[model samples]
Target: MNATAKLDEYIPVVGQAIIDDLKLLAERLAQKHVLHVNSTAVGGGVAEILSRMVPLLGEMGINTKWEVIKGGDQFYQVTKKFHNVLHGRPDEVTPADFEIFMETSRKNIAEMNTDYDIVFIHDPQPIALIQKKGQNKWIWRCHIDVSKPHPIVWAFLKEFIVRYDASVFSAPSFSQQLPIRQALISPSIDPLSEKNRELSPEDVDRVLAKYQISRDKPIITQISRFDRLKDPVGVIEAFLMVRKYIDCQLILAGGTATDDPEGLQVLAEVKEKAADNPDIHILLLPQNDFEVNALQRGSDVIMQKSLKEGFGLTVSEALWKVKPVVAGNVGGIPLQIKHKYSGMLCNSVEGAAFALKQILNSPAFAKRLGENGREHIRNNFLLTRHLRDYMLLFLSLDYAEDLVYL
Candidate 1:
């Protein structure tokens, strides 16, 4: 199928009215050259969103291209530190960290082709690419929760951030009091993508057998990178609490991103916390979206127990499958979940355990939450909504009066 026709596959999920509106907006942005730059082509939400978004935008008659900036091990190490510090994590970042980041940024700036109608940069790893701006509209998309960023780190990043024509944040709370115009656009998942696609009963069972996970007990799975911010260890702690009363197994499945240096360290921490419990399966999953889809589809309940989040795409992924979700009450997660209506939101490990138990104990309540959550995701968190928002953001530069919020 052609790009727009391929996008029409979503028409059944999102109504024709939405698709028509997108086409109308796409007409305004017809063949408009847009370049998206980030640190890596694999792993992370930014990459996943762009993988579907860029292609669909091309189908919509927008000349969209994605670029990954080149960097060495040391450069990613510094950026990962910047990522941690931006999310209010305690990291001992030094001046040398700043130098390493720029050293790589300078190299990328010299090599990358930045000429386009709109230059969209995702996160801090590429915020410095603003140095190559020349007459085109530049936009920086921050996909992380930066509500409590360290001053030194924020200041260093702010120098480049302010240079952009506009900035996009996943949540309103994540928006800093910045000089540039800001737009609130949450990240999203493709309902048609493998990670969120519907899996057959046999397919689910096959994946479970592959992982040696049994269907005899309730499965509580959290699909995320082994990042401390995701709090996989805390998920294990909550799962342990639930297993004390209920016969359930925990699956902490995810792999490290090329850009993230601490994934192995965090995985080690989760394994140690798991403590060789056969009930807990710690599978370091590769980029197998089908396996993820099977796990979520086969599970009785899904959890995204994040301590800090930019917009938990996993929460939306589970909710789209009509699975009950228990997520943290921080960042963009609250935007996806309405607490007890769409899905349960928890504040602590104890709270997560309590919510998980509530879902397990009451089938009616879990079903209602799952049903409400699917509709919520349908209306707000799907890829079509994300496309509409992005097309609106891009057209705003020309039709300035059309977008007053930005």
Candidate 2:
């Protein structure tokens, strides 16, 4: 909606050298059309990144557009089951589910446009669009952790995935043994975006009070979609464990995604689990970036206890704010946090609780970790770095046979 944010704006945060390099890379792919197609345009991380990334790509002289695939309730429900299976969950995906997906994909394929220099199909929902691919280059971007996916679901999706010219994964571990080439491009947070940008003390206090959250005690917050993989119930258990040692409040704040049919069920389960505890607050927030920013800024500590995660962008988001985070040591979280240095990584509820109590009791340790975490994000996980990687990746597609240097 706003004018494409100039790369010069990021020079102060990521330095001038990074911006110069991006300009050089963007020049190589000038006027190339790039189309990013995904399932939703509003809720999830893929949409969030493209919302900002597409406009910037246009500013870089690359013709870019983003589109969302159309699907019905039955289609989305089947895809939600597919999502759970991809995350190594035991979901009995029936033949009827597969049929529903193919039927929906067929409809999307017939209605959507495929004319672009480079077409990026994100996740499994729209992977079948490659069937309509012409001479245009198509890249499949997998945002979920598929290292150990359900054999049936993985086998089913592999048929569509292998057809892409290349695939992109958030982390090396999240990459599967696909026949196509794989690129490890981690997701990033836009420092200039409303979700991660600086906020005044008054704004933070206003957000907290608006939510009716008391600041009498230290607050522990986790901002994620209410998905099963995020382990919202596990976060509650960890909070209860920490409550014995420290008097802190827990805030499980997140909204739903259009394609994720299980979100309401997961939120209900979390509410049932947290029913008796008055200190545990479960706020079903809308996808408001400023509110999320204020919540992370106002919290004394942040937690992301995902049973399985793709990259855990929330971990990086909180770290960007210089908040000491206690996150699960699975998926791409370890890459963001070097245990006990930038932040603490836990494997179980007990471990998470221990880390929370340690950080809450020792303000000095928390401050040091928070500072280190912020510097780490500034160097590696900013939106500027993500843009550079993507621009280079797009340029690399042209030199597929040659050993290209980026």
| lDDT string, candidate 2, 133-188, tens digits | 88888999999888788888889888988888888998878777778888889999
Whole-model lDDT per candidate: 0.89, 0.90
Expressed as tens digits, the lDDT of each residue in 1-406 for candidate 1 is 1223378898988999999999998998886999999988976678877888988899889999999999999998898888878878788989999999999999999999998999999999998999999999999999888999989999999999999999999998988999988999988878777677667899999999999999999999999889887899899999989999999999989988766679888988899999999999988788888898999999989999888887778899899999999999988999999999999999999999999999999999999999999999999998899999999889776654643632
In model 2, where is the ten-residue run with the lowest total lDDT? 1-10
Per-candidate TM-scores read 0.88, 0.88
Clashing residue pairs in candidate 2, if any?
none
Off by over 4 Å in 2: 1-4, 212-216, 225-228, 255-279, 400-406
